[model samples]
Target: MEKIFYYFLIDVPRAMTIWAVLMVLAAAATVGLIMRPRHSGTGTADLAAEPGGPGPDGATPVGAEPALRAEEQRRRALASRALELHRYAEEVTVAAERSAVTAQRRRDEWLTAQEEAESAWQAYEAADVAARRVAAAAVLPEPRTPRTPAEYADRERYLHRAAMAACTRKELSVLQLSDALAHRNGWDPRRHPVEQEIVLRRTVRDSLFAAHRAATERERAAWRDAEVAAEAARSLREEAFAATAKAEEFRRWLPSSPSAGSTDGTAGGANGRVRPAVRWRAARAG
Candidate 1:
């Protein structure tokens, strides 16, 4: 019983170690097989030499050189086709990126152009207003030939006649428009006849309004011109007064005239005679 127990402890351990070592070896062998290069056949020239193994007449065996060459060519063709596909994919990607960049640039350019256009329009409007103001403020020349009261009366009469002519034309237009509208009920109000008549009436009315507005604008423009002329005349008078004052100041510094006792430049001195004085000339500007 003692010997049997000893064998169970020691021999059982040894047997287990042997089984473990066998399992490890088997695992290593399986891994090597999986990693190894595979082949269709180990050395099977009989299958490659011909479709059917060994001819019926039992001729000598042919080599498998043709089959080997065909397989090598197929592999090279497959590699070339894969490389071409990769190059095509790269080209497509580059084209897409370039298109995206170009579109973004164009969008920015368009936005910039729109901004420039708007700014230019605003500047133009500002310039126009400034020009108008400058024109309104510009000085007017004094009349070379003054107009007589009879000429002024004649001008007023002409303006009155023009106004009367405009009124007459407006009355004629209104009469024509009324006559056209009188036929409005002859056809459906929504139909072309009535609609056309309504459109014509609106057109006549708009024309009359436009004419009235134009006449008002003309009168306003004339009044503005008159105001500008008046302002210019006042400015001219002020400038004349300033010139006269400046001339008087210059006269005080001039040498004494022949009638004066002294020709000297200075004012009265201790000797009771004017000292040498500076002579001034009137400088006219062109």
Candidate 2:
């Protein structure tokens, strides 16, 4: 009975040892199984929970996202500004072209006006020359000699009276009246009246009468009116001359411009400092 009891005790110790070894192996296996991922889902869940990992929320870091967005926005703004600048440049180019066209048109108009003014002046100069030539041709020759002393005396008396009357009118100067009368008779004073003794007396009487009449009878208003008419006629002539001159100047300066038309003063009229009626009569006589 003692041996049997001993054997049982030994078997019991071996069994307890085996049981402890099994328990240790089972605990290690339980820990490994609990820590292991079921599939890749648990790993993906863990990545999602962490920042800057493979999940959607973790793809970009929290601090870096704003910086990336700011960079993108800045690039877009730059592109927009570039487009606006290009459009502005095009507008400026168009405006410049329009300005150039307008300026050219204005220049063309100025050139045309200049040309017109030049042509009118040339016509006036030609007319003026012709009129002067006509006046020179109308002068009359002096009479040769008187038939008798009585005839000479009568002629001298008539000339003296006419000169005095002309002087009284104040239209002719002394020199002009003397020249007219001298030319009508003879230029020589010695042969003027055929009787030299009475010549001085007749001349003195005529001069006194002329002076008296001029001092009393001459009207200021009439003279002024005559002068105004003369001035108007002269102004017309001057204007024509100016137009001609301007045309010449234009030709000299800008040959490509337009031509000017004829002006009014080119034709002759009563332009002298004389009464209109007298001028008209004189013109007719010429």
Candidate 3:
């Protein structure tokens, strides 16, 4: 019985030593495997090459692990949205600046039109004064030389005729004189030059006034467009801020819940990560 006990004790130590050595070898192999470089056909490589799963480049590859892929997708989607909103804000800002410039230009044009209208009115007034003076000069009483000599009477008649004929100058064309004589819409036979001159001056004045009104209307429209563009740019900037804030939430790793049905509505990934199951739009309701 003593020899049997001694043999058992010796065998047990050797078996224990062998088991410990095997455990050490297993641990070393596990560490080596963990530190090894990956290539094709390896599990990690296969996961990276999976089709239709989101890669680090913001593309989804196929056959990727569902939970990890979903986490990546959530992060990428948030980042993409943030970048897109930032770019949109920039574009809107540029548009707002352009609209403001257009409004200023319209305002300048409106002012110029006002000046032109004033000048045109002045020209019309001057023309009207001259035409009235000529008309008045032609309306003198006929000379009475009945008791005078024949030469004196003829001279008096010639003087009256020349006064009436002086209103229409040689510069006036035959067609213009005929139109003035014919008494058209706004013409009068007694005031030939006044008829032609007043019509032309009034037409120019009316045209300038109309142009001023149109310029004013265009200025108002441009201002409205500028205001609208500024409002849009402001709103987009706020949205961009909100989007950036929301994207920042996904920058850190979110721990997964061990519960099968989490009350917080967080979805657990296979690698102890989680994604918010609910939409992140609660802050933008206003």
TM-score of each: 0.28, 0.28, 0.36
Model 2: lDDT equals 0.47
Candidate 1, residues 101-204: lDDT per residue as tens digits?
Answer: 55455555555555555554454454345445544433443234346666555544443343344335552244443443343323122222223333333443
User: Which tens-of-lDDT digit does each residue in 1-286 have in candidate 3?
Assistant: 9999999999999999999999999999999999998675566555566674456565555455686557556654654454445444455545555555655666566566556556655655655565566556555654443444665545444433433343343223345344444545454333333333445444334444554566556656655665665565566556655654545464334444443434344555566444455443322211
Encode model 2's per-residue lDDT on 110-163: one tens digit a residue. 455445434333333433454445445445343576578776677667656655
* TM-score for candidate 3, residues paired by index: 0.36
Please report the candidate that would top lDDT against the real structure. 3
How well does candidate 3 score on lDDT at residue 273?
A: 49
Alpha carbon lDDT at 118, candidate 1 = 55
Please give the range of 10 consecutive residues that has the lowest summed lDDT in model 2: 277-286
Model 1 weakest lDDT span, ten residues long: 185-194
